[model samples]
Target: MDLSMDPAYSITKSECVELCAGIRGEPYSVSVLKEGYCTAQSDGTFRADGTISLITGPRAVLVDTGGPWDRELLLSKLKEKDLTPAGVSVVVGTHGHSDHIGNLNLFPGATLIVGCDVSEGDRYLPNQLAEGQPYLIDDHVSVIPTPGHTGRDVSVLVKGTSAGTVLVAGDLFECCADEDSWRDLSENPELQEVGRQKALMDADVIIPGHGRLFRVHRTPLN
Candidate 1:
């Protein structure tokens, strides 16, 4: 069934509150390496970039490395965390977009998870992301498939966080105020809408692909 044409999905956008929120958890602390942005240039072109984040814990995970232009900044941020490219145990590219995974070469030694593909060098690690299953990283973190903006998008769900559950969602949400913009940029708006609704339901805080962290405020049941 195509949910895009369904009335049930008519108001799928969540009630969100944009804020500079911090999501800290035991064994894992989430930090935004770079808050992404998209702006119109003087020309017809657009200046767009994806968000980058560091999830520090027993196994350090880097989410969305930003574009190649952010290499220096990415390195600087890692140094601030007392980490080098080698310190990152895993690099997750939420999708195949250049703005999201351009700097992946910086972490050659790290396990690469691009969409549903989990690989280490030439060897691929099999998982069930394509089957709607989440790949658990530990007791607190898991990478769940949430395809929408692209056919293979995924998000990192960090449980037991200071802000409850923090989802490092890629373009699953263009931004907190993206209700009028996401569908235009999505490859499959229907699927993306489903993913967005699920994220809003499951996470208390969401780190979007091109904006600051936002809190999801669900209406209480009567």
Candidate 2:
């Protein structure tokens, strides 16, 4: 369980920003605000409208945008932080949930990055598939694709001496302990395995989309 030795432990230099409601113990600084709620899915899952800002080098990246109710709040928060939608280098929607893509229209200058199965012509405008591909957000950081939650979901991984390797799990591991919530991989096995492997891998820090940030404790896995 030596995370440092994990293949996923590779590093690259970059600026980082967490734009969601503040996670309790995460490394990046965040601006917190009560946003809106996403529409309920047929499965009855509901997501709150909160976001995190990750700034790397001279570019700023927004993880997920809160819902319509908080679009103004997001804009205000960005203003408070001296960030403008026009200044954003990229927008990473963890998944296609309304809560995550609400303010996507705000970033006219940014290239929208989603999972491989996502359609570029979809509502998220200017969408592109991640496909586990690496995007250089300058010489410092990259947005690595790790789809699971939804067919097109992806996460952001930041690299820096101060941060080491940080994984923005999106919904990949909704919370720090969600790795154990799975029963078997038979249902959508590939996604389950991907999520499991990511959780088992070592990361200096894990930034979940909804819950607080946490450090992983090593657990032996077969």
Candidate 3:
């Protein structure tokens, strides 16, 4: 798939700083770290987004670690931020895709919170359904289940600084294309709609798996 077609394919202008994207929500700071990708399978190449490095004040986490092919470059990104692999407190993959989990093992000391394997931690989230929230982080950073891109896929939703709500979506949009590529890129297209609805509803700014950060513009569904 030629990802250049999407409006979000351009490189983000800002680095790690607070710039308002006009989302009506809480505050959080961010650094693009790497532009995400459109994962396509063919000839032993995993074309997908690079690691999405996010800073939510309380947590220094990476939603997806890009692909193993670019592991060193991803590490250098952390270096540029003065953060070593051990410094990152948490690493969460949106799903089990190689592009997202390529650098998981590098952060062995960090808590692994992804899919059903997410470790049990004492963190409370104040949100719509506050009773017995299972995820490790607080409502400040809520984890939403988004299966379909991969059956165990999940998206990390956190209130941002100026951008409002930010989601480190795994392969949620596979680089933020039209709904056509959205469904076409999924492992199970039939099951993706449910996840899609949840993503659109929960996030205002999506740090898509393989694309630049894009504001979530909601519209009525057919």
- Which sections of candidate 2 miss by over 4 Å? 1-47, 117-131, 182-190, 199-202, 217-222
Looking at candidate 2, the ten consecutive residues that score lowest on lDDT are: 11-20
Considering summed lDDT, which 10 consecutive residues are worst modelled in model 1?
Answer: 2-11
Full ranking by TM-score: 1, 3, 2
Which of the two, 1 or 2, has more TM-score?
1
Better of 1 and 3 by lDDT: 1
Ranked by lDDT from best down, the candidates are: 1, 3, 2
Residues 1-222 of candidate 3: C-alpha lDDT, one tens digit per residue: 222223433322222223322223344456667776555577866555554656646667666777787689878988987888888887787777676777777887777776645642444224322232335466577667677776767777777456667777767666555447677667787666765655565556676666656665544434
Better of 1 and 2 by lDDT: 1
Instruction: Report how far off residue 41 is in candidate 1 (Å).
Output: 2.4
Q: Write the per-residue lDDT of candidate 1 for residues 32-126, one digit (tens) a residue.
A: 88999988799889999999988988989999999999999999999998999999999999999999999999998999999999999989999
- Better model by TM-score, 1 or 3? 1
lDDT of each: 0.85, 0.56, 0.62
